[model samples]
Target: MAHDHGHDHASSTRTRLAIAFAIIAVVLVVEVFGAWLSGSLALLADAGHMASDAIGLLVALVASVWATRPATDRHTFGFRRLEVLAALFNGVLLTVVAVVVAIEAVRRLTEADPHAPDGIPMLVVAGIGLLANVAAYLVLRGGDRRSMNMRGATLEVLGDLFGSIAAVVAGVVLLTTGFAAADAIASLVIAALIVPRAALLLRDVVRVLTESAPRETDVTLIREHLLETPEVVAVHDVHVWAITSGAPVFSAHVECEEAVFAEGRAGSMLERLGECLRGHFDVEHSTFQLEPAGHSEREEPAHR
Candidate 1:
């Protein structure tokens, strides 16, 4: 029963990630071609946004696969952290793309005779991108929001949606007022939107790599909860982090009322505690040290 449930969950996640990547890649290709045909900076900006979305979705998909790879003697934790690294890399690349786009847009506004032939193509491409983004967002919406990897994919879709809207508005302005400069202005606005989101994602990915606490969990609160149990005396060396994106893992040393000989009861209680973590807090991996009152301090603790 438990085995089938776990397999089904993993399969569902994999299928969703794959679909999102497919949508992003297809829409991005269309936007790129549309931008070339229209010569509209706003359409190009949407293309750039979609290009980054494709990369983000690819990273998320690859991470999902890597996360399931079996652990080996050479790599104890498997490849789960690759997801965090991929997210960080995606953020950096997106930030760079945004900066380059902004600078180019500004330069074109000053030097080039920036003129768009017609607003129709821009409007059409933007509309398609908007629809694709919304559909992708719907697919990823049910996953764990605290998963930085998943959050990266979600933000990419959202960025594409915003970029599409900006393109549509620029098209409208060009059609009505002959203000081709609106296209350039829209590009800059899209770049500005990308900057903050990329920076925030980069910060979160960095925190995870540095083994900082997971953003959604509080170590102190977890310790307090453990201490509330009758047999627990104190909790120390408590560490908490995510295994992949949605699966949090924790390790800690808990002082107990009895000696080390009381392993049976302690083990059962810890098992129950693990179940509670999975049910309530979405923690998938847990390792706890059963220590006598002062036994933890007497010797070096084991690392699981």
Candidate 2:
């Protein structure tokens, strides 16, 4: 079985994430200062979100770099799963930030006669934040979104984009109507936007960590395809899972005709089975054990 080593893909993605992190880092500083100067909770909430984005980008960048390291005997997968772990951490961080923002927003909303937030500075700073997020989004947009690591970073940028938009709206409302609650309302909206995506990312990470089959692969269909091959009597003990995004591995035991084994055609049958898995199922890594019928009953099978 051939392994598709995505070295170039990982390298390019790392570069993009690094650049995006730099852009977001600058924006985070600006927003924090702006939040302080304007006393706008919306801007503060956006700043907090941006801080999480910066951390998420850093984790993604590290994972990308770690994923490229050569495999060792102790760690055969060679840090590939680091990406998934990073994504999990990012999701948790985002949820925590959202919770904190929501708590503060609720407090502001209920407090009587809150002072009007400074709108002019909030508007100016939030506009700059929006522009920065737009640039970050564009930079990270070109990578494979199927990768959990990239998706985590992309989600951060996406959330920041929405946060900036909400801050701008809050600034506008507070400026025109002297409504201080608008800032708190915008913070609440930003928190709401963060929950769904963070939950999705967390769910995906958990699936991978639990060694669940990828959502796209169907085990029943794979079993049928193997049974269709010539001289194959039965198929059993099939297993499929992903090593990482876009890389699936499979293994199964195939019972074959006695003649096929006696004639020394087992190797040919094995090759054909591998080809079938690769061509039909996009499974590039597979191992098939060819055995005569009843052989499984004779020997203790690892999986019945």
- Which residue segments of model 1 deviate by more than 4 Å? 112-117, 143-146, 259-282, 295-304
Which residue pairs collide, candidate 1?
none
lDDT of 2: 0.90
Instruction: Kindly list the per-residue Cα lDDT of model 2 for residues 189-292, writing each as its tens digit.
Output: 99998998899999888888887788999999999989999999888888888777767889898999999989999989999999999899899889998989
The superposed Cα distance between candidate 1 and the true structure at residue 43, in angstroms, equals 1.2
Kindly give the stretch of ten consecutive residues in candidate 2 with the minimal lDDT sum.
1-10
> What C-alpha lDDT, on a 0 to 100 scale, does residue 160 get in candidate 2?
88
* Most lDDT-accurate candidate: 2
* Model 1 lDDT tens row, 7-78: 676577768778888998888899888888888787787788888888877888888778768789998889
